[model samples]
Target: MDLRALTLLAGANSSGKSSVMQPLLLLKQTLHEDRYDPGPLKLDGPNVVFTDAGQFISQVAVGQRPRFEVSLGVGKDRGRLLYEPSAAGVTLSETGVSVGQAPEIIMRDGSVVSARETAVLLELPGLEAEGKNSIASRHGIAHEIPLVPWVSIAVVDGVLLKGSVEFPAVGWKTHLSNDLMRLIHLGGHRGNPSRRYPRSVSSSDLRPGVFHEQAAGVIAHWKQHDPASLDALQSAMRTVGLGWSIEPVDLDATAIDLRIGRTRETSRAARDLVSIADVGFGVSQSLPVLVALIDAKPGQLVYIEQPEIHLHPRAQVGVADLIVEASRRGARVVIETHSEIILTRIQYHVAKGTLPPKDVLVHWFACDPKTGDTTVTAVEPDAAGAFGDWPVDFAEVGERVDREYIEAAWKRQSGEAG
Candidate 1:
């Protein structure tokens, strides 16, 4: 329904997940520049053919002697191409086709026009006339604007379609590279990367001065939306079943120290201080990402990999609820996940009317090692509360473990009889 938001392209590892994402990114590039040679095409191999002549001609503009036009369709929008007559030969970027200088063309609007946008239009090869261009004979024309590029982060250990963003004019597909850059550029954003939390202030928390501005943005977000009342935060923590009481504290201009209760007496009033690493893997991994999601503005698509890793069953369920909260608040979330606990929790919330089922759908990816292919199925529940097509190979490792246990039980029964 909200097509731009959360959509999962689920398939097991090496099952063409990245293959799908790459082409979409290349299509986005085509919107700005006209059709390019297959050699330069980022998505497919050089020999791959994308479009034919009929498709090419339709994209051309038929107007004044030298003007050109391009027409195509993507999703719900029909792309209109228009080019103008110029002293220097006019070039249509879509098809990489160019006509002599100063040829006038009639626009789709029935108005005579000229310029680069038109060049972009005429170059689109929806249907091209024969002998259209040198490249057309070698490589067919390509139409279609790349809306948003796809980015995959790990949902557990495999790829998940976190979210997609439309290109500028359209917009850039900024989900993966941009966000990763933000974190990387923050420079010295070390928060106990050693996977060990210190009892007191340590060297890991000491970041360089260069991170001041970026750290400021991070701290501001916590102060703005995190609960003001320590009690409220504690209650929220309890609801998620985490035993710790967390309070936000300003560390410096760019950092907020999260204090958790330590002792029984002071624990009532004093929040426990934690080395980010000392916490459970789930808390450290999910918290920073959740913080990022809350900080994002509406219309931003947040692509997150498996948010369930290392989390307990209850925490997995809580993360599902958190995702619902983010979606309701207008941040679109596209997540890749494998935890059945997370899946069950989402269904439970939907059934209880905590979240609308229509707004969310679970896609299951089952990999078949025999064929070396992965099959994708929608995992929506029916009235019977069972997934429609539960592939036998959904979790190969689990299946193996179950088989071993059954065999062991059979052996024990035979031994007892003897």
Candidate 2:
């Protein structure tokens, strides 16, 4: 799938929306654990776990090979990893790497044959000597050779690579790798509401699906080091009509308490603090999402599943606005949601020109009744935020219910009058 600056996945349960995210999460976990070599892809990890190959693969046909492919990057500077199920593990079948604005270097199966072919196709001079030396050095065929500064060769075993390559003056390899490494995902089932949170050292990287457990610690760390971030989070909460500020109360060095202070005008004192559990459930449910978005740094990709959960319709729209603000601040945001309010808010933002239409993408997933396969259709919005051909049965259940109630009420009134 082609991901834009902001992508929204909307569909029914088991319609394959989460299926798109599972493989990427698996890859992220594998890369994070540094276990991407000499094995089939690791199915069980800290972030996610699968029992076996049967559970991981879909649409199984007897005697047919099971495989998955992931393609990333943009334009000529792109990479693709192909995998096949193996008894020992998931094995990497092949890899395709392209760099430079014009496809200068190509590596397939950890060999430089594609590079030589690319050189021949482009008719680049001095490639025969430079390409051979680079490939020899990468494969350990040569200990030392005069290397070309513009061209570099690298090898991959499975999905792991040992070295870095530079694309002339571009340095696309490092840039692309860094982008991939910055991916962050928050699962649908987030941390539950608790009275006290543990005080632990904050890591530079946020853990997937554990934002709730880390919220208090991250808040305390930022409160001490980066007060502006805390202020931003408070501002977002206010925007969502929460009208409360969050503070971390140290129970001791080992644990901290999260206290919510009233921010709205009231007869009581403004400094009065209450435990998060004492407040509405939506407050605790949305705290992590607000903190994550406001804390996002530039060029980071943030994935949030069901941000609208436990929120009122108005609050859901407010969360949508927060997502847009996060995107505007230079972070890429992807969300999966079932709330029509959130979708309507997004359309409003696009139509009012608060956000560019091209940067927003909406995908509607549906399952084929006969084949039991999932199909995705792109729902495009124009400059006016109007979508042509809305997806079938998208948020129509409420209207149907209302219609049924009105019909029954009319029949009862007619029978009584007769």
Best by lDDT: 2
User: For each candidate, what TM-score against the reference?
Assistant: 0.50, 0.82
Q: Compared with the true structure, what per-residue lDDT tens digits does model 1 show for residues 309-338?
A: 656777777767776776666655666666
Give per-candidate clash totals: 45, 2
lDDT (Cα, tens digit) per residue for candidate 2, span 1-418: 8677788999888898878877667666654555335243557764568756667676568888888777767545666667776776566665555554455333334444443544432344334554444544543221222222332212224423433332242444455544544566667776677877887844665454346667778899888888998998888887786656777888887888888877565654346778888888778878888887877776788888899888877778889998998888888888998888888898999999998988888888998878988889887689998777868465588789889999999999999999
Model 2 stretches with alpha carbons more than 4 Å out: 34-40, 102-109, 112-173, 196-210, 241-243, 262-271, 413-418
Pairs of colliding residues, candidate 2: 40-89, 40-90
TM-score for predicted model 2 compared with the true structure:
0.82
Model 2: lDDT of residue 11: 87
- lDDT (Cα, 0-100) at 209 in candidate 2: 33
Query: In model 1, which range of ten residues has the least summed lDDT?
Result: 151-160
Model 2: ten consecutive residues of lowest lDDT: 140-149
